[model samples]
Target: MTVIEIDGLSKNYGADKAVDGVCLRVEQGEIFGIAGPNGAGKTTVVECASGLRRRDGGNLRVLGLDPQNDRRRLLQRIGVQLQEASLPGAIKVGEALRMYASFYDKPADWRELMDEWGLTDKRRAGFASLSGGWKQRLFIALALVGNPEVVFLDELTTGLDPSARRTTWGLIRNMRERGVTIVMVTHFMDEAAALCDRIAIIDRGRVAAEGSPRELIAKGRADSLEDAFLVLTGGETA
Candidate 1:
């Protein structure tokens, strides 16, 4: 069940090559990670695959459909949670969920989602007042409102404290357990190792190496995934 397929994918910004001849395959019900240092084009890869951005060269398919050609049809079947997930400061939790649900032809009940994500009590709370952790919970809730088969989570736990990060990881695992395919983009090697079934390390706009965390460590002959990433990327920031 290969849900996503890419071969020689490329994207560019002006004269700069943001993604260069990248290839990947993501299967059903797996947590696939795209990890890389800053400016390595990790986000661009997902954006292109998920139909957020158009590619300059090569081919990609998401859920057996061409992302660019079938964007409208694709959007209905996939959910995306971006790193900069944000809403108006005055928007309440319930309001936000309701708004997102309206975007889908067939959506999950936002109220049920609120309760399931522990935001029922905060339904009246304003977006500006919610803590970082609570905001993330809401973001995940919003992503699920469409009841999508595949979800793209980009840098999902980037700024959270340890506790919040762990909680977010639990939420991600819960998504996987429910048989949803996940494509995660992050720079944290430990997070990738902890949650991802397989990872592709992007460096300088190309896939430098890709495998399970342990397999990558074995390939680099390093002590850990982080060390292997550092070795693979020539000490670039993880």
Candidate 2:
């Protein structure tokens, strides 16, 4: 089943195009990735799909529902963790989780989520006091708190240390195991290569290549995903 479908999707910032004629599809229960260098329109595409931004031209569907026309219903079924997410400095970890969980009609237990995400020990810790990795974990927990069928994670592990990044990879795999579909926007080549079942490489507001990591490497005649990305995007891959 296709959970997301986009065709000729385009977005612009005045005269400059951020996303241009992009076409992509995401199937059910797979971790799909959108990889590119900064300013490559990777974020713009997902933002449009998530209904955070409007597209200039094209058709987009999330679970067969129009994102712009059916935003209210779509928001209820999808969870989003933006690239730069934040919370009130004084809010405790548990408090933040509880507050977000309350917004959903059928939310997961916030207490259990804290424990699952290794935030139980820091439940009372203020949001501002948490480290980058901890903050990332909390954001992920909050995104999943609503038990959404589809989850969008943008630059999810950007600031995490190596250990935390790998831990998050495991968590994402767990989410997929439980039948959730994932769409991630990331610049980390190794991260996307390791986690994404398939990926679309966007560059300069267009899709430069689309395939599995191995396929992309072969197409670019490179030994690794990073090198392949660099080759395809003319050294523009992040």
**lDDT agreement with native, every candidate:** 0.91, 0.91
In model 1, the worst 10-residue window by lDDT is 229-238
lDDT of 1 by residue, 78-122 (tens): 999877768999999999999999999999999998988889999
Candidate 2: where is the Cα deviation over 4 Å? 236-238
Model 2 lDDT per residue over 47-139, tens place: 899888888999999988899999888888888988888999999999999999988988989999899889999999999999988898899
- Which pairs of residues collide in candidate 1? none
Task: Report per-prediction Cα RMSD to one decimal.
Answer: 1.8, 1.6
What global local distance difference test value does model 1 have?
0.91
**TM-scores of the models, in the order given:** 0.94, 0.96
Off by over 4 Å in 1: 236-238
Candidate with top TM-score is: 2
